[model samples]
Target: MPDNSSYLVVPSSVLWLLGFAVVSISILIIATMVLRARRLRSGMHAAGATEPTGSLLPEFEKNGQSAAASLVQWSPETLRHILAKELPDAQVIVVSNREPYIHNRKGDDIQLVVPASGLVSALEPITRACAGTWIAYGGGSADRLVVDENDRVEVPPDSPSYTLRRVWLSEEEQQGYYLGFANEGLWPLCHIAFTRPIFRASDWESYEAVNRKFADTVVAEARNERPIVLVQDYHFALLPRMIRERLPEAIIITFWHIPWPNSEVFSICPWREKILEGLLGSSIVGFHTQFHCNNFIDSVDRFLESRIEREDSAISYGGQISLVHAYPISIEWPPAHLGKLPDVAQCRRRIREKFGLAEDVKLCVGVERLDYTKGILDRFDALDELLKLHPEWIGKVALLQIAAPSRGTLPAYQQLYEECLHRADDINQRYGREGYTPVLMVTEHYSQVQVYEIYRAADVCMVTSLHDGMNLVAKEFVAARDDEQGVLLLSMFAGASKELLEALIVNPYDAATMGDALLQALTMSQEEQRQRMQRMREIVRDNNVYRWAGSMLLDAARLRKRVAVDRAVGAAPAAPGNVISLLDRKRVAAL
Candidate 1:
């Protein structure tokens, strides 16, 4: 009676409906959590099973006969055996921008230097095992001196196992194709690290021309009709399509070794359609994670009118279905560098002596190229905060930053190099005493042995990337610490975080939290370090680079067989002179 309309009383039926909806939502969330828990439990239980199960190559039936499912103890030897068995007639061809080994002029002699690249580290071992041909741009100073008349040279000067085909690029081509488009445009676009991507028509043109150049080289290098081509990284996105167009029967597997942005983010790129279409030309498109694969699929949905079969993770376009999958890249187990490094005690003592630091002082290592996306500034800022917050650690804990010079010609990278030096200098000025520098910044390129020595020496290894495909440094750290003593502070943004579960995952954006993580790593007990490191080691060991390569190769083999059957049954037409990869070529030759 007293303004009942203003009181806004709900009806009993409506109230019941609202309550029921709320209950249903809550039940759904709880059920989801319960299911997730059950899955984790089941996985843990399955880990104890003695029966062999395929962890990478899934059980697939062909022509009503199922392939025997067996878990591979993935090693270099095992990988070779599998490669030989999977595609006996095909060649293994690895194509990338950076050569595995660089020939630099060292005074009067040519020095065979291995570039500090995660790509090289991962693929070199596989090539060695398979005796594959690695085709890359010849950017090194003395690259032309060692190559034969055919622009090819056998690598591993100590023990030649594979061919290194060098593709010469002019100064303009290097500037526009590599530093301009690849790094400035695509790299920053893919990784939203606050830097605006610089896209130019000239850079795009050069990129296309370079891709064409590489494609011609690839076609010329193909000894077999259908080579198993592994087109590596962003630099070769267009190369896949170029090769596919020419050699329709060639099985091209393109592995994007970087993070793929969401549709909205990728929409900013003007050539997004071309890049997407180029990538789709592969028989398989691989990313470091499923999240990236999803982002790529979403981008393709927005930009291209391709048929995306969500169930199979395959994209159909131009009468071809490209299988998109996650192949988490990893470092080699018992790293090649490991055999060259000294014992932990010796490493610690020698590094401290070299740096003129006391033995008791803690050494924290952060290794990266002088690139903004690596969050080197954030790492320095976090260390600065840690020192400021904890005065007791002022002279006790030191950060040894190992920054390798990369793309110095780029304005952004040059600025980063300067800023990092200034920042390190400021911190040192504020906190340093004679023989007690809080921050030791080394910018010179270090060999694998020296890097591994530092890894073994440091009590903590920090990889704080703003965003990364998969920072192999994290895995490399775990591999180097076979003594199971070092702690790894990894960025949550890195793809490696998904695999290295035992690492101290921190957000690179949060300085305070990262500082705390550093403190935690510094103060962690030896036993705890051993436990965490042991877990990471097992993960790295089981899922090594050999396993990574094996997984891709296995999937490629399955697809090849499928295509062969299709052709045999006249379901698919055959192209003339088809078949093989850098691996397929060398491995077939090796066979």
Candidate 2:
């Protein structure tokens, strides 16, 4: 008892020193923890671990350099390597309505024709880089000629790289699915360009059937492993849910390659809720702009009972969270052989001769599919107004409107084509001279080389879309202008208008304003044209198609990783019950 009391009763100075040392040590430990925690959070945020507050645009950094900033120097090999790093054991599969290469019957010989598609140009490199499968509709006459027994062929015949899996649909299926539901219903529904959307029960049934068929093919191709499936456009809006039902673990990404109207506008569809549910099945849904992304999220919030994460731009439904992001698509930059001024000049000469135009005449070129959305009629009206306003340049300026025929079977498209012809005729009749036509309408397909030549030769390139998601024609024109000599008369409605601010943007709906823009483009100084084209070329060259695909892929991978982490932490509950409630409580407590 005496020894214990002596041990307990220490010296006052010694006790004070011990107390000071303990307090100092505790403070040091706490300070170290605070600093370490800050560093950890900063590192996680840099690595895209923390959810973004607004506009969840992917910021990819490599070698301490922004990937997007360095995209101009990156080759397809670099993009492929990045994909391999991001998805180690996963195979990439692309699903779209249009095939990159079409083996069509040209006379007796079957030839491969790469259709004029921005989607093809953008995603083809990704497929080639990953050596993946691109599943598309086999609409070409000789599409079956090139495919192996598995209905798969290595595309871009001369430079075979990736597998092209063609999905053949019956005539009725194509009619109902593509022409009926997709073009008539979803196309008009999405684009708020004053076109009425037509929805029919038969078309809906056909659309569902085609979606199921595609999903089956995708699943069969996926087989044992869960592959990353990238569904393209509105044609397969229902495919995501179908694929999700079959393979819940698969990483599905759907990119809507058009504008998304507001929720009120979108609610006009009879099966809007079903469409929303189907879209939410994806791990991620992408749009071309932030406005479109917001529209999609708002539409989902309005139509479905889902937890909308406004900060992250994600929707949590049925125990899963799907990210919604904007990935503005673009064209391949610095088009091959664009710098061959001698060749371009020769092609221009040939084009002028074929079209019966003088070499000195200022050529305004507009290239687009013959669709109402392209504002072809509006372009003609502008041309008519251009001639009327600028009487001096009646015979000096001509617009070479090369409209590739599209969906000719549809009445709307047919009427559009007819109206364009009538307008062109009226303009030519009113303003044409012996050697010059105000508008030269070429209703036929042109090869890529020819289109590039047109782009290089033109004094002005016009993209007058009523509404579009990244109209690549503008970018293509920009890429082809190696000399930086052409003016871009772009419509304010196009997605490209946001990036190509140097272009003389006009409202296509206003004919008089568009006429003035055309005149301004025609009368622009050579130096001004060069400056504008240079800036636009830089923009296109920097934000090329490769960067677009890479950004989407990186974001999709991050979303999948986040979902996996949530599942591991039991934050993603399968059913709405006590488990979810407990997880929510834990999350709130942790926060």
Candidate 3:
């Protein structure tokens, strides 16, 4: 009121200042976003530099509206070329529960650590075959990623891998997702042992959220017209459908790393139909064994009650959707060359010293993750019973039990660990004479080299999974033992049992059976062990991991037949100077 003219001037100046502040704030925010985007782009670019990209996919519509069978018979190379074309800018995104490469981010730099997955050995060839990108979620907060000496992010060709973002679960979320959903529910349910599965809505909700995050990542990474996405295992079961909805044109492939139970067992899942539909959304679904594939097909038909036409290698449902057939897994045998290394000999000696073993004790080794499903308790009980029944041979033979720690956070796993420890202690207490503990039980995990050495030195290799998708360990042990000397005591329940029938089979659930099998194996003539090992090795060597991968792709290609056709159309009108005919065909070629 005292100075009207001066007040008006002050108000105008204040307005201008406010406007400037708002503009500055907006600029800063935009700058931050730009920097973040650049960082993400740069990371992807580095990973993709070595990959192949282009529109190599066949225009299926242009391929004469052929049926699924006709499509499979197409030349493998041609089909891959077509697929490569479709994914012209194919950024191979490999999404899994575990990170493909563990990045140790320290300030402005990053260090990558790769895990020792047997799957890697089988898929590495395909990864190396194609140019692609890779993404993955790494080990949980505590366990550091296990890196190999190679210092390379090992992956297949025609694939780019990257990790999906997981909201580093709080302690509560972890319990619900890992403990409640994965272990308590899916773990037991999938194994057809439903007594332990406890249904929880909240835990399942968390699992859904986690899988959605993975879907979001795939949607964000995939290009509009040319994206082929591959999802691994059960952790992200709903991801295929989620991504399918967003990227309708993209080709999705889902591979189940675990066994899919039959109708009777699968019915227990509260969301069984949802899982089946989620998988069905993919253009292709792959399983480790034919039985698993058949089980999945049965689930879809029984639950969905959908009309399915089963062909030789594939199943066509409702004509529009085709569920392709064939097995898609193999073991990475650490080649014969590995045996020649000086370090190999050294590792064997180290294994002997670490366990304090004498040269004469016939070492029978069982190396497995310390999980309840591994039948570790049964193994211990069997060993105990064996020693009790046959006291004379106690010191003559040692069961080298290497129980590698896995999923220790879960209560069930922890209980298993405690039980294992107690069993080991009891055996040592009962059997100890002067120094040697009959059961050389190792709770800690050894390096891959050490494991290889253990496999080489053992007179017998044991695979005793209660319910396994495919115990590649059985195959791996056989591959490593080129001498074909070790007798393999395989569990009848394991998927590997279907493939490895020559080995000594035992019902892991029955301690008596296991003990008997063990005794038979121990006393088994050296010649018989060699013969069985030889036959198993031949099968593993001949089929090989490389052949397994190639077979899948080949089967996919073989879905349809390829007929020689001209680049230009015959009956249809040609554009201006470009006239062509189907009659002007070249000789058909094999892929």
Candidate 4:
């Protein structure tokens, strides 16, 4: 009876105290979980570690994991071992239009700037890994200040490894080959971006001269040794053939960085046949997506008399076969602590202060080169529509458009730049407040650290490329979001959209739809943002620039083996006294 009375007499105050304790413990558990997740996220970013999301190439899998480890996790030594195993005794030589490190005169001292390019990010590691040579156009003002008599220097200056062999291009050569032929001709011709390609005979001649120059340099570097020559992008469409002519024993692999239009569209190029013949000199030719590969193959089939092996995706002509393949390029994941650096907060603060943005105002950032293909004008249109539809976000959201000037000499690019400024001005005039402009357009070139700071500070990153090979800015933004916060509004036209499915994909042409998407991105909950960003970060971290390079090299190696076998079976004649081919034959025989 005493125990029963004691139980029944339990005080309401005691019950309230117990309930409070239970509630506090629950909150503590949730908070701990949230903190633990954040710590794990930070650690993964720092380590460039990612949970495997299947494999990009199932054939290159060992125990359900890709042989090519995440760039963050894989060392240069690891990559070297892989290259040795894949193509033993073969030296790698990379050819590209853009140099990895450009030396410029910063006041009196020589300053090296790494240009913004997916090619540099992808191939530079391969060169470092294998101690290979990188042949590129020396367009920097002070390029000669660093190079030796051989036009060669070890890079990057901070931690030098591998050789950088620069091919000097005169201002006129650069203007005609790069700005005229590459940008005005091959660029627009391949992109399907509605920009009419301007093909000039002088431009074509300059392009040819540049290719020959690069070929001569590669031949000198190889010097009686048959090396693996990787020709990059449209700037060197004729480079593969030119190199092949010089070193017939060389294993040439050309990777076209832009999209290949349908045969109908590509027929507009007066030099289409020559371009096809030049590309066909490669043992392998790669594109960013399968659609591009198919387009290239179809174009060759339609325009040329080459025997198309549809099953193998190979074009047979000139006593050689060139295989067409897809290799989607990506960005190098920044050091895990990049966003967590002590200076990042200061950088973010500086950017905010520079733009006069308030603490509560959310940032929507767009980083792009001022070019017609980048859809800078379309992005502004979407922003204008966004403010009109959602009046509530008028002062709450601000767009920071960082338009890096590109090809300023080109009339189309110049017009695009002027149009971008005009559109941004019009938007600001309509929706801007006294202290807040809806769009803060920054046209100056920003250092990598500055760009990373901008990426880290943004609540949303808009990649509205009208058409692109693989818009790497989308991947870069994903890599910079170490806090697992931010939304990605990626253009459906970009090749990255195929891989980054978690992003809010929209057509840059649809302003109303994009405006609604902007609203959705702005209003997306913290949990939703974390989920989307986490998935994208994992994808980008796993399929990084190293993986892209490794995958391409692996395919090239496979094609090399196949070609050698085909030659052995009398598909083509092996060059007499070609020790390289002999070694390859012996290796194939042993296998």
Candidate 5:
């Protein structure tokens, strides 16, 4: 008791020193945090992650005019104001599932890294060159930014002209909708694997809920002006209807990247009607080929009992009031047209040497992503049949199948990979010399240059997809063949096959047809191969990806102009102006 007070009370000099030390530590921490924040902002700026603000459009003046008034009632003035500022002039937002870059951890922080793939080439410059807005979710490597529930990764000001937004999905929402329903249920079914489709009531509900959430996100993000919303693929089919309901004036354009099966096959799915109605909500629907467009129209007609207004260039749903057209999406070939480098020749030589082929041996190549619909097994069977039917060509020629690894997460894909391995082994064992394996199969993806090498060296290019939207690989192969000594034996079922009639078309399921076609292609004269390949190059070169994108945008813009004119003339009474005409929030909420 006597010494307690003295012990508790420190000397004034000691107390002062302790206080100074604490303040110095506090200052250092604050300084370090400030420096860290500045670095983060710089990083975000470099990665093109800044939020878009103010008028995004320069051509249109901000004088309280609405861009979408002709299409729909511009009720919300804020949406109109934002659209006047954000569209057609500022950076155009190209929304996708994944962000452009991947992020890595650095001692409680994260760093962004770009993916080395064809996607990078496809998206990077397209996004960077645009002076419009880009609204995309933080996918892949960019997911690291949302490490904390409360913390938000700031988008820096000096970032690229693109405005990338986040549609961060909760864990439950992702598992139930994305993994469970979208992948397991719709993905397999859409690809025409009816037996494999895993349907669940709960999954359907989750998917609907997620669709509603996505609609909410788009409605919240989109301006009320004429925002050209180019929605991509089947994953967001429901989004079109949602967007149409919310932002009816927005010019919504959708492109289906996958194959559209005929009503006979497409009708197998329980969600067929829902999918069709969802797609019809868009102003324009694009398909890779005429057959796919026809299939879509046929499906809508049969399933929904809907009338179709068929025109020479386009087809319109009678009741839905949406247009469907074939765009035949393609790759950019002008870069390749610039001139071949010396490395291309060297690359071809290197690929031939690496594959351990005799200088005179003919190479028949088929490159594809390792998916069930790609007909990997059937192609192998056809190859086996060819080798068995004609023993003379076994050692003389080889089948080089480049099955690129994709969707390995799916059990069906894993099983297909295993089947491929087994078949490759069986073929080699059945028809192999002391040092020569008859079938030269590789189960890995090649670099773009490597792919170019295969295309150049290949005597015959084979695209045997059971179902494919538009096999760009077929076009790529044709484009790279500067020598024009490549015979393309393509599948009739593929959407590209209709466009590439010059190629020797065969049914993938019909073994006799495929075998006969492959053998004929192998024996075809160099002149014939060159002639066929030249025609294909002409078709692809004329209808490149640039043309595809430009055509869609121009078409939609033109349609919007007509609608605008009609609105001005009072011919379009559907879209009445004034917010008061719109159903109140409470009434809308009830619906």
Candidate 6:
């Protein structure tokens, strides 16, 4: 007992030395922690882990406001750089129903054809920029002939910037999955069109089978396990989850290119749960508008047993979280097909001559697929009413209705075409003189350059969809107008309407109002046209297709880097915030 007391009472010099040593150790630990924190911050910044400011718009974007000039105007070069930084070794793999270029048989020689599809228009630039692989359905007659053993063909025929992998589907599979389920079921179900969605057991089976097949193809085509897969459109709603189940590490960005109806409307689908689950399998689910994003979240909430985080715009389901965001789709700025486009004046002159019209005749154009959802009949009705209300426009204006026939086998579309033709005939008969046709229908598919030429030539471009995602035709009309001369009559229901506010927004359902809008467009002054077109051009230029792709990829990049950082620092996602406790709180409290 005496020895213990003596030991406890140390010498004064020894006590001072012990105290100095303890302080030195404490200082060393603090210095080490400070240095480590600095290093951690630097590493995080280098890894592209931005501070959580809770904003979706990147630094480069600023809503096309004149006060806020874009730091980076998105281009092919910028997109390539973004891909290099964000994705590094991983290539972008696009899963789509339509190919950028299709091989068709013309006699014995195989000819390449670019499909006249909005989906193609939106995605081709990204594929070309990244030199990435496009996985699409091989519907072409000679698609099998052009591809190598891997069913891969270098596209754009002449330049060959990217490879297109063809996935073959049998007739039965195509009919059931594409025509029956996708076109008939999902298209009508999603669109505000009056047609009813036809869901068959056979079609659902084929849809599932096709999605599974595409997923398997995607997995095989992936350069790495964690490839950036962009699942495109309603054609492949089940694809994201199918890809997810196979390649758990893959980052899937599923873009719903069509308008996502409200939850009440979405409940019309019989297999709504499956669709919601499939979409939630994605890392990010992109829509054309915030309204659509809300609709999607509402749908998921209504149908699924998922954790909804509205503040974060995220859904946690099946041990994973999916972020739902609106990335308004757009056409390419200085579109890829602008290489050989004639000057605007020349385009107008040529188009007037092509249509056998006088220079004074106002050229109004409508470019879309011949689908009921496009409101082609409504456009014709509007024109009919326009001529009736103002008979002066009867012979003075021409609506060059250029429509590529789509889903022709469907009764709704076939009926729409007939109705459109009859309506066009009635308008032409009632209005047209010897050489003036008010409604001229071009039913054949036109190439991108051809469509651009049309867009450039028009005095007015009518994108009167009853319900639409971001109508690229509206953007295309804006993008094509270097002269800033045309008027864009966009439907209020179109997602582009919300962005292109300068456009004469009209409800496609209201033919009388649209007729008046058409009249107003025809009567709009050149100065007013310039102001509106200039503003729209700015919007389209600032928010082009590359920006759309870049924005989503940037988000993906942040998410990827965060996951990597968490894993590297042994940060458990399930743990509380600030998981890495370099200084033990319990020890500090005891001290």
Candidate number with greatest TM-score? 1
In order of lDDT, best first, we have 1, 6, 2, 4, 5, 3
Residue pairs clashing, model 6:
none
Superpose all Cα atoms of candidate 3 onto the true structure and report the RMSD in Å to 1 decimal. Answer: 25.5
**In candidate 1, what are the lDDT values of residues 46-96, reduced to their tens digit?**
222111112211333333221221245678897788778878867889999
Q: How close is every model to the real structure, measured as TM-score?
A: 0.88, 0.86, 0.73, 0.83, 0.73, 0.86
Residue range 357-474, candidate 2, lDDT tens digits: 8977999999988888888888888888887877998889899999999989888888888888888898889888788888999999987777888887898898999999779899
Return the lDDT, model 3, position 565. Answer: 24
Model 3: residues with Cα > 4 Å off, grouped in runs: 1-91, 103-113, 140-175, 193-195, 311-320, 324-328, 333-347, 556-591
CA lDDT, every prediction? Answer: 0.84, 0.80, 0.62, 0.79, 0.64, 0.82
Q: Highest lDDT: give the candidate number.
A: 1
Model 4 per-residue lDDT tens digits across residues 1-591: 355654667699999999999999999999999899766644432333332212211222357343234433544555666688878877889999889999899899988798766577667777877778899988888999888988899987878888999998888898889999999998888776788999999999999999889888988999555688889989888888888887877778898888889999989998999999999888778887777888999999899987776544666676666767666777665543374444536656777898899988989998877778888888888888888988888989999998888889889888888888888899899888788889999998877667788888888899998889888889988988877888999999898987888999999999999999999999999999999999998888766776667665666565456447557777554321132333334446558
- Against the true structure, candidate 4 reaches a TM-score of 0.83
lDDT, model 3, position 50: 9
Better of 2 and 3 by lDDT: 2
CA lDDT, candidate 2, residue 225: 45
In terms of lDDT, the poorest run of 10 residues in model 1 is 48-57
- Which ten contiguous residues of candidate 5 have the minimum total lDDT? 49-58
State the weakest 10-residue window (summed lDDT) of model 4.
51-60
lDDT of 5: 0.64
Write model 3 residue lDDT over 90-209, tens digit each, in one string: 555556666544456665555444444655544443444444434454444322333333212433212443223322445666677667787788887777432477779998987787
RMSD of candidate 1 to the truth, in angstroms, is 8.5
